[model samples]
Target: MELYAKVLNYTMPVFLLLILVEQLAARRMGKQVNRSLDSVSSISSGMTNVIKDVLGLTISLLTYDWLVGHVAIFKINATWLTYAVTILVIDFKGYWVHRWEHRVNILWNRHVIHHSSEEFNLSCALRQTVSTVFDYFAFLLLPAAVLGVPVEVMAVVAPIHLFLQFWYHTRLIGKMGVLEKIIVTPSHHRVHHAINPIYMDRNFGQLLILWDKWFGTFQEELEEEPCVYGITRPARTWNPLKINFQHFWLLLRDAYHARSWKDKLRIWFMPTGWRPEDVKQRYPVYTIADLQAYAKYDPPGSSGFSIWAWTQLLVCYGLLIYLFAHLVTIGFSHAAVYGGFLVLSIYAFTELMDRNPHAWAFELVKATVGLGIIYWLGDWFGASQQYPWLTPLVGAYQVLSFFVSAYFSAAIRAGQPLPEAESVHQHGA
Candidate 1:
């Protein structure tokens, strides 16, 4: 089999597994796992935007390179130490960037989109700005690129970091107990995503918890006080364009309205939702006190089975992701990962558009697009070069994915209320 085909062999399994897991998580959380899936979709959109920006920047960088020969700051003599150092340094940079995004208004405007989620799950990690290449690329890649780090090495580093961080977005895993004392556990990150004032600005590390601990920003999850996920001000908007740019636009408006340059500077540099001269008043205060006011849900009488089924699905998805990793390391190029992501993006976007029964056609369109993406990635990754017979292997998976998505979409539309917080109570359903 070609490398793509080999990858597809594994990739298909991972996709199936993720879908299963998502279903399980949804059931466990007593909501449609769409929130989690939406997170993935949002992140995928941000990634796509980032890629487009990177391509443009690459062109500009190349143009500038003509004026000056390519130069690098680091040597290509990579060692274990180099890799370790690279990971640590990248992590630290991310920490600061993430922290700054929360602190500075302009940046926070972009970063807060992630925090706008009213629910916490694996997909929240995907909530980010695609145009943030300008803000993040240099800090992350420039140092390594200057040192002459191989692009291949750089590529692998990002995915590994992402893979490590991916599990942190979930509510499925509880605190790691002792490990939570040192590592960035899902429980720890939950605090970071909480709209609770005390939890805000805590636990910012992507892979390492040390940054938060070292910086005194670490806060343990409280057993008695449940974390209420999302920002004080929920976005409430569904327009992707608005969701992406709303904060930035708000910042610009505030900046323009300031009477003095100092006030304007403060507005831009200060934390998002901060208004000049307002000491105690903060915007979008989504405290536990606030959320408790909403009416509670009692899961449908059949939810025990739903939760169990969803759990099984999660296990399957996990297996699929693992298989994908193996396939990538074996013979597949980066395209396999990209292909898997394409399907993930499609799956996620489906959740986003699923709010309306009238959008059923959009669901079909997304599924078809996902199938096509799977086909392209399978062929592009070297399936045709190895075993042509294996081409149909991925093709089959794509077909299955499409049909499965359509089935789920129809099911969801047929009065199957998507998962919500109230749905997950132990006493319910």
Candidate 2:
């Protein structure tokens, strides 16, 4: 875990830089692919995912080591060929797992966050999942296990493979000439992220496009059928926590009120977007039935609110970088506590950004928690020990955060219409 955190300390900045570059590049090309608030939400979602991963919040039902040991049919020598084969096996596993997540009901819960953003930009790619607490991706690694790939090799290669998928998530680049046929490019992934009928549930490749081509799920980007990003059932808020579990909550609601026992039992495993017939008719969720007239969720917000949201995003990111840098020195307990605080900090500011009427209350809770952490630890996990001013600065920020949140909360209370401000489609004023 420490190693992973350290690795991210290097890679994460690169990811940030690429996001900026993508923004600039798109603007240069006269395209508006990213909105400031949407980008903040996307990056905040990334931070949550990073914190969860660094804390090792997930557990596989079967360990890769155990799988390889029990199922190895032939022992392959540890050479370049071994690593090459490992990538292929892992990519194959990724293709099937991704396909299932888009096809099955329960599995989509872990993937919806990735597709929640209405805009298709590099930052939206960062909208990853923190909801996949007990994952079963290892079960899909049967071919790797059968090939007797070393566990160390898989560990080294898996993260690289995941990182490789990041660059292709941008919209700045169009179709790559020959490479389009061989690898997953921006065009292919745009299709994957699109909600248009032709683009829905296609292009499930990780590093290779061949899998999609072979599996008959490939769809080329057509100029006529322009891509409309986001899920059909829109994630209505700026809260990543809510978006992460919205589908699962829907499934839970449907299963409980489903009337028929068989319908309740099968709701979970049924095809993605399938709800009980009775439940669907009675409590219909708002889905965009017509792509022609659909609009992106964009609420009004003051310039002050946008700046504040960006500030919170930056501070939260800095806090995460600090936690990662000091993961070992701080120890697990401190890291966990700090991680929890970061989660609250994110939830507080983001809900406030959403312009929730009760968001100020969450902001108050977050401030109290921040102050409590400072008091309980006598420092911020050893930050005060190095930089004496950090503790007070962090404490001040918490207080300042609450006040800023209250100001916006007041605007929301005043029945302020958001038309004069920027967008995020919430109660934002």
Best by lDDT: 2
Cα-based TM-score, every candidate:
0.59, 0.95
Give one digit per residue, the lDDT tens place, for model 2 in 227-248: 9999999998889999999999
Scored by lDDT, model 1 comes in at 0.56
| lDDT (Cα atoms) of all candidates against the true structure | 0.56, 0.90
Colliding pairs, model 2:
298-425, 299-424, 299-425
Error at 62, model 1, angstroms: 13
Root-mean-square deviation of each candidate, in angstroms? 9.0, 3.1
Per the 3 Å backbone cut-off, how many clashing residue pairs does candidate 2 have? 3
Q: Write one digit per residue (lDDT tens) for candidate 1, span 208-326.
A: 89999899888988998788876665565432345667677666765666566887777877766676553223322332456667432122323432342243234324323333444
Q: Which stretches of candidate 1 lie over 4 Å from their true place?
A: 1-16, 25-76, 136-152, 277-289, 294-429
